[model samples]
Target: MNPRLKHLVVALSLSLLAAVFTPAHSADTKKADAAAVVQLQQRMDAAEKHYRDAMLAEDEDAAATATTSALAEMKAVVDACTKQRGCAVDTMLTTYERLLKATPQFDDGMPAADEDPLDERDFTAANVPDTANAASLLSEDGQRFVKMVQFNPAVQAGIRRWLTDMRPSLMDSYENYRYMQAQMAPAFKQHGLPEALLFGIMAKESNGKVHVGSRAGAVGPLQFMPATGRRFGLGNDGSGFDTRYDPKASADAAAQYLSERMAQLNNSIELSLAGYNGGEGRALRVFRDTGGRSFWDPDVYNQFPAETKDYVPMVIAAAWLFLHPKEYGIRWPSVSSRPSTITLAQPASLYELTICLGNWGSRDGYLRALRNLNPRWAADDMLPAGTSLNATFRISWLYRFNCAHGQRMALAKQLMASNVQSALVRVGEPTPAGSPQVAVATPAPSAAAAVPERKPAKPVKARHYKVKRGDTMSEIVRKFDCDLGDLAQANKLRKPRYALKPGQSLKLEGCKG
Candidate 1:
């Protein structure tokens, strides 16, 4: 063999080895590039998510500023990647551009430090409205109300108290007022009265709680006394239910009552409000004696008691806040006030409904709204199937989603069916020791044993008893030693709140007399 031929063979083998290893190394480099692209994409997604979360911050100005900064930082990262070799710059730049275009404009006005007292700390009884600067903080409209109400030191004090110490009560009133505005406000509007005046009176009277009753027999949202309520058709509605508890009825009565007072008091709103808080008779007598003087007139104001003096100013202050909350840096949370109706698909109470309809879009559940809208029904009353109820659109949506038929509905039903009586242990029962407690089944009495030998009582003819004023069925049953269930069944009386009327006759049952 020639020496040159041997050398050429070795050279060919070396060339083949180089060709094989070069392709393998190129494949590894491609895999590394693909992995780098995935890592870059993930980082971009995380940055976009951070920006979105920052946009939802409660402080509008801070949210806008943070979102803009986040977007700019993301853009810089894309530009840096674009200058690097083998980087997926085209895809990353496209994502960055899309995010920039979709970002909201940052034009929110800065909020004052004192504008959001609630956000400064968790809401507690201790940290309330700071009224030291209330006069300076008053909105233009609030100041106007002050002038109209004869801005005295007492009235200014009332405004400050409502703005700071009683702020939660004010917010609650606004929330409740939103639900009943459709029903109650129209009555005031028809009578040519400001709706804010109605809200103010209602807030002061009951904080928009429809079922509230004063110790003096004043009832409903407006706190009308029994006699005054009767004067305006707010007494019993003949269904064993009082119209004084009805928001719409009470609002109408309040409108009529206020209108009458204004007419009698020479159309002076202050005097009319005074007459509302005090007696109309006293208000008229004072106005007549003063010869049509202002309620703020020292002589005219001195005639009223301390309560009336405080009442007039407090109501005015509440009305002022209702008209101009934003001026005081108060932002009433937006509620879905669109009204809707819901017919119970089955027998369920307000309590059951509230449990099933979890708070999806609200801070608290919908029990208060339900009670306010349907004041006729008690919270625990099991409404008859097909009963119609007034509810908000959000509540209706939740009802359809959770209360219609699902685990939520089933759980709610199970909760409603629960009875403490069923779980009650005998008072004298002993606790089991060192063993799992077992339920014992009571033996059924034999048929013959169950049927007790009966002895008939001497016949005492049944008699009818006349129901006196303020007599409840239970009281009458106890007085006569009658079997309550038997007496109710005999008179066709309903259970749990048997309706009775004066001079109505009830036949005695299971009585010895």
Candidate 2:
């Protein structure tokens, strides 16, 4: 061959060789990518199935375990993908999106021990687990739980978008969770109630909201209804402590109350839960009429109210989630074991502590720790000498002025008390809407009134509005910004939600009020 032709021929051969290898390498990459996609898809499906099972289960511990297992697997797949050089994690992302959109919503409103499941099963009044419920499999493993639940690409993306579009409070304060937990151990310990049990209770009771209250009059971190609370050592302490609002005191009371209920109800968590909500007298009465069988018996379980039936499972479900977060794919929460609260000899104010700490942030975590430790602190509490505080004391972090819990409590005894009353329920006296209100009178001259026989400043016309079926007088007043008391007076209606006939007319008097 000619020299030029030979060189060109060699170049052509080299180019051909490079082209031949390209497809082979591409095939290898594609095969790996395809496998990765399959794995991601499998993980997403598993996560969904596990979460559903956990939610319906009444055995929270079991549910939690299952949830943890589910998430652990999911995380393994994700971790592998993260390591892949040419990974198209988009499939994982897509799977997440598909599942989040496809799966049924778990909790749109706050969760509660008495809340009904999204779906019911073979469970019936006759067959429902006496206190059965559900939880997710992803809840078991901490890492998997976070990937599947908290940071699931699809669900989290959607959650982020939804939250951005409509502002709402989704994040929480550990203070509320801790307060609930602290209260649980002390109170239940006396009655042989397990400390771990508190996590489930607090999760369901208030979703960790300290200032929570139900329309039925339940209040505080534990959702103790006023009447029930008063009966169970939860209210009106001699020292001006409303036990319902006092974490330590209330927890102590709750433990005692739960123990009594459990024993009275034959040591059945299901039956005890029923008693907690449906009233002990009623639950027992129902059981008495029946064969007095176990809670899991459909016949025995059905004896309780709908709320009671639902309550048992929810508690168990929440507990399961706590124990096995992997099943639901929630984040691996590494909460330090809550420290024991040590009491001081004298009261110390939070403000004083903050000041004494020297340059603590107004909303710093340390201050939050103080509040969590002593939830009963009113704005003006004189954290009395011997007052208890929950803390993880570390002298190396910051010391000198701040002593160990014991010494600090002793010093606090000399400080003036705080103003706790000022810290009473932030949400108070719900205002009713859409009721008629009377306006303050701007009286015209008496002489002018006499001339026109007092054409009484547009003799406020009483307008007639139909009362919706669920309408409450308070609701009506709130809608209309009317005084509830005035609405009752004007309507001469005895009942606050005066059995409004659909065509009922609510008369607003004076100046078209």
RMSD of 1: 14.6
Stretches of candidate 2 exceeding 4 Å from the true structure = 1-183, 294-303, 327-332, 336-369, 379-513
What C-alpha lDDT, on a 0 to 100 scale, does residue 446 get in candidate 1? 95
- Model 1 accuracy (lDDT, Cα): 0.73
* Residues 1-513 of candidate 2: C-alpha lDDT, one tens digit per residue: 899999999999999998999899999988987887676667667776875565454433444455556555555666776776665666655554443332222222333443332123211311312221223332123233223122223323433332354112212322235323434444554555644345446655665555456778777667788777877767656754455755666667667777887677666655666777778788777667775666667787766777776556555444444444334443322122223344443345564565444322112334445554555553333455666565432111122224333344344433423222322332333323542343434555687566665445666445756686667654565355454446666777643114355567786532112
Pairs with backbone N, CA or C atoms under 3 Å apart (clashes), candidate 1: none
Name model 1 segments beyond 4 Å from true: 1-148, 424-513
Clashes of 2: 95
lDDT of each: 0.73, 0.50
Which candidate has the highest lDDT of all? 1
CA displacement after TM-score superposition, residue 469 of candidate 2 (Å): 23
Task: State the weakest 10-residue window (summed lDDT) of model 2.
Answer: 392-401
Report the CA-based lDDT of candidate 2 relative to the real structure: 0.50
